[model samples]
Target: MRPDLLLHRWSSSSVVILLGFAELNFPFISSLHIHVELLRGFCSDNPRNQQYPSARIKALERKMQKLGEFKLPHFFNYPPYFTLQPVRDTREKQIQLWKELILDYCKSQKTFVIAIEEEFPLFTNHVIERSLTHEAKETFLSALVSEGRAEWMDKGHRRCLILWHRIQDWADILIQFAKDNGLEDGVVTIEEIRSGPESQGTELHGIDRTILNRALKLLEQKGKLVVFKGTSTDDEGVKFSI
Candidate 1:
């Protein structure tokens, strides 16, 4: 066999092996294959030395642009990150990072809830065509729940309330809101506090009603405020003593 032909055959076989490893979800091998695939054209003797076709380049650019203002971390594209790790230490670290990322993403986007069955941007990496499995999503969110950073909205765990700001934090924010709006010694309706002009443009605006009620209850317990139930739910009012 010719030396050049043998080299070509060996290279082709190596590529196949790398792709096989990638298909098996080996992160390091998959990453290596991706790099090789991206640079193969540049390494070849093509006159243009173009790394990829124009259409592919444009597609990549569009994917990046679609990410918008929320900058995803580099690890998001790592396929294994989407899977639930079995090792205790590794899984703990993964869960911790996922919790922080979920909180940060929800805070940035002002997203208050995450439906497990729904398509969450943070749960999918389009660039790598990877997504968190149902079990993996539940595991990470459960970790957050254990830490009081999130809550299961239903007994089935299909819906999650992401408390980027904890109940205590929200209560503090409520106190500040009262002071800011000169309602520290006055009364305001529950609905008004949620969507009124004073609440608009603040973090309290558009807060999930469940979370808002929890915060209000906490404040009520502290004797900082008194919640009065009205004939109509929307007319329920709070009197601030602070």
Candidate 2:
């Protein structure tokens, strides 16, 4: 075999091996080069020189645009965001950004609940073909739970209750809602508070039942309301005496 041909074959194999390693998320990959000696042996010239920075930037911009209310930082598209940063400072920033993004997404979308095994739109970026690893998802969600902004619905952490608004805040809102509807000393069913015409066009509309129950319990403790049990568990009602 010709010496030049052997070199070409070796370089091609080397490039493919390095790319495979990268795809597999190997830690050692700083040795891959794009120079002629590397690509001239096997790969074409045009693709080596074409930088894809713009693709990443545009992909990130399109994602934020699609999210509508989830405004991402400029560094969101900087490639490294997809990886778990090893450095303490960088990892802290990354985690903080993820935390803020999750809360902002939940708040804007009125998403009170998130199941880890379910398809949550914020967990994946389709344009970039990037999705959060299960570990990453749990890590970010745990951070939110630590800060009291979220809670695990079960011990296994399979589901999460995202409280973009605190229970106290929600309770206050419910009290104000009741007052606005002239419901002081009036009775209202749980279903009515969730889906009735009076709740329509308000934040209370389609609220998660669990969160509503927590808010109601808070008000009940404060003597603002009395919950009455019914024949069916789903038919619980609240009588406001405020």
Candidate 3:
């Protein structure tokens, strides 16, 4: 150790020395000791951490982005993201956000069905390694069903089909599309529109059968498409009319 450097460093701050000395002085010493004792007591009982709030706020920000609402982030700032939400309003709002995000993501990706048992893109935050628990997924899907935008294709919500566009909207699209493709009074195989060249790359592509059936039923109720058994064809097909 260099004596000159040690002297220079020690002499750097007079205030630090004074403050240190003040802690030993009788009047200031008692106050400082009381404060230290209080702090130590508090720490021993329950530590006040600065990290807890910062981590909490960051998680809140992520959930708020899912909400896509104009309100401040703290409205939904809660600790239960790690624990599944249980309160009715909180769970409702949480489910609403999840539903909206799922639909929005699907609309962007043209994903018409969400397999509840499968890993969904928005459900996992790989950076955080957090995902919706199975129960959370079911709750959100149930919320969508209550709103008519999603359906449980099976009794078990192992597969929930999403419809960013409602079945009514799809029926309208079918009517317009039938007119566009000159099927106003014509017959086409269900498979042809579902996966064949004519439906390639269209909204009709990659659509779940249950969703298609719902849409078809919607149109049938409106007298647009008629379902009939095809004895000759392998697929019992449908015919459409304007």
Candidate 4:
């Protein structure tokens, strides 16, 4: 018999042999038969040997490890995902996903701001050589802004302030902080609420001054607290009533 034909005949007979063993109830034979079927299916489905390079695969794995517990969605690797979809429904869904991802990533990294033109790790997939275009970035960030999850820092919309926790949420947190630290009726400097020892280790620590001001203003509107201007902006004080 010709070599090719002989090999083909053997391949056919091998399945039969495995099936016979499986039917005989041999230990492990059934699993072996299943694996053989899976291997055959894989070979048939990927006849072109389409597979990512080993080095690229390893590089992606390392990059994921560096993300440090922030798990990216599987679709993040899809090439088309990097491009803004033209279809209305598709674009909406894509924008929603991007908004969620941006919020989640910023929260995980404690990232308070994102410059549209700057290099944000979440905006790029080095493994696939894909990154969001400036327009796409703005689109996604705009969606976030509409939902009150983020704010544009400049009139040009070049910079965005991420609010994983909304102003109301931050106000609630501030109230809790006051209750915890017994500052409900006491005066506290703005700096103290930001970097004071009492605020250390809390979400208030190292908060963006802009966001801090916004949160304080919301509390002021509700009469929950009164902000007192001092000699300098950093010298501002707050007197909590609740």
**How many collisions per candidate?**
0, 0, 0, 0
Better of 2 and 4 by lDDT: 4
- Name the candidate that leads on TM-score: 1
Best by lDDT: 1
Give the alpha-carbon lDDT of every model: 0.77, 0.73, 0.60, 0.75
**Which residue segments of model 1 deviate by more than 4 Å?**
1-54, 61-66
Residue pairs in collision within model 2: none
lDDT of 4: 0.75
- Candidate 3's TM-score reads 0.61
Better candidate number, 2 or 3, judged by TM-score: 2
Candidate 2 lDDT score relative to the true structure: 0.73
Model 3 C-alpha RMSD vs. true structure (Å) is 15.7
Q: List model 1 lDDT by residue over 1-242, tens digit each.
A: 96434444444334433443353343233354353344343334433444445555456445633356887654564566777778776677677778888998999888999999999998887765679999999999998899899999999999999999999999999999999989889999999988999999999888889999999999999999999999998999999999
Say what the RMSD of model 2 is: 8.7
1-242, model 3: which lDDT tens digit per residue? 76433333332223223333333222223332332222232222233322234444345335544433333222122223323555666455555556676787787677777887787766665423457778877877788888998878888778877889898887776777678788989888777767777677678876667777788888888888898767754475779978
On residues 1-242, what C-alpha lDDT tens digit does candidate 2 reach at each position? Answer: 97455554454435534443343243233322332234344433334333334454345345645566566543332234555767676567678878887888888888998899888887776654567788888988999999999999899999999999989999999999999999998999999999999999999999989999999999999999999999886688999989
lDDT (C-alpha) at residue 61 in model 4? 49
Candidate 3 Cα misplacement greater than 4 A, ranges: 1-83, 86-88, 231-235
Q: Assess every candidate by TM-score.
A: 0.78, 0.73, 0.61, 0.76
* Sort order, lDDT high to low: 1, 4, 2, 3
